[model samples]
Target: MEIPENYPKKYWHCHIEVDTGGKKNTSAIFNDLTIKELWQQVVSPWHTHRPFTVDGTIVRDYDKVQKIKITQTEHPQSYYAEQHNASMQRKGIADMATNRRLLPLSKGKDYTHEFLFADLTMNDNEQEKVVSNNKIFIVHGHDEQVKETTARFVEKLGLEAVILHEQANEGKTIIEKLEKHTDVGFSLVLLTPDDVGATVTDKENLKPRARQNVLLELGYMAGKLGRGKVCALKKGDVEIPSDLIGVLYVEIDAAGAWRLQVAKELKVAGLGVDLNNAI
Candidate 1:
């Protein structure tokens, strides 16, 4: 076969630099040949061997090296890309670690220690798993302590809570995380001044985050699934956005006594079922 100039073919070349004999030792060299040629070169000086020939070609086992030369370097992601990548990697590591121990002990031919599925599929599956695992509520409000306390209250009812605090911290942005919540069966947003003000105008001059990521998420749920799948959890003091006038909102206090009530709301929303429990 004709080898292309760009083909990355690597071959093993062996030679001996040390020798021992009755007289002074001599060095021998062999170029681009098999182990047999190397041995012959070492032994030929002494006239102690018969005819020798290399048995095989070194270029035969170079597919991996060849492929490596053709592979492109991986490019770094933008800010958003980095956020999504980190989230994906984190979830992958978590799922792999958790499922690693549960994997079958049998040495079956089909069993594998590492899974090589698509990252998108794994992430989407993780989101679905999260939604079905427990009742989840997305709380957004002006007062950090108040909104957080409400989420904590929801957690007290044995539910999942994700409090999108108004303060933009060093963590992942709201839009980055919301895209991964595909199977988010139910969500609740606490619309406040900070949440609305943080939104930026897009090229279309539309306020994407006007209601915060919670609002974008709600819009996604409404458009994809329907309006019944999401709720608005707001304190009585804040004015509700005009767009969310008809949506349901669960009002909670800072004392964390409303946990059971939030759990009841989640049950009413039909997101209290655990779908991943069987697997």
Candidate 2:
């Protein structure tokens, strides 16, 4: 593999949190390195080690090193956050901690733990790679809370949430990756005011709108999966295209409230979701 030139302009700000129980944890590191390189350098070394047991939990740090969370900012949501904290990639029971019996062995307490590696890094390109998984493609602008909440909600429903910003696409562009990952069945677009657009003839009039990239993704989704398979959850003041009049853009002040409607739509699209029990 060709090594990426460490661009002087692109310095990654990272924050690592290492917890070994007893309420002790270390802060993340912010430096001039990509998420992939950090995994190979810092995380991999101390993430998991021998003995295979610590304070009732299985692996030391587990995937805390392997699966790095990518974002434009330090916040949790911004764009394609690591939705599924527990990666479906791990194969056997050795790596999968939740598969075995509960640790600490509390009858009524139900204490469970997994490596949540939320830190600095950028995957040039990423989405859920599982072809058989219930993949929900979440598209958004700069909102972090909505994206993070959406990812958690999707995982709560036992479905795979495919996030773009967390994957390493090495040499390809975002548009290229979208064309490649066509196995996705459903899409949730988050529209927030991040940009202002005015027509060429009417330069004086400016209105709240999503970023150009978000618009491009939305248009791509409409063409690739049809309007029925996509839902736009607009949070703030934003204007959309007139052609998308038939598309459903639900207005909401918050994020998690739209799960029921989104789940219902996913069910109709043949995802086998039970919205009745979901809250």
lDDT of model 1, residue 196: 25
Please provide, for model 1 over 36-152, each residue's C-alpha lDDT reduced to its tens digit, 9 standing for 90 to 100: 333233222112111122222111111111111001112211333454457768887533332221111111122011111112222344444444435454646345765676566
Alpha-carbon local distance difference test for all models: 0.40, 0.57
Per-residue C-alpha lDDT of model 2 across residues 156-237, encoded as one tens digit per residue: 8888787888767978897777776644767888888888889999999999988888878888887656677789988777
Model 1 weakest lDDT span, ten residues long: 64-73
Position 97, candidate 2: lDDT: 47
- Candidate 2 weakest ten by summed lDDT: 103-112
> Could you tell me every candidate's TM-score relative to the true structure?
0.38, 0.50
> Candidate 2 regions off by >4 Å?
1-133, 200-202
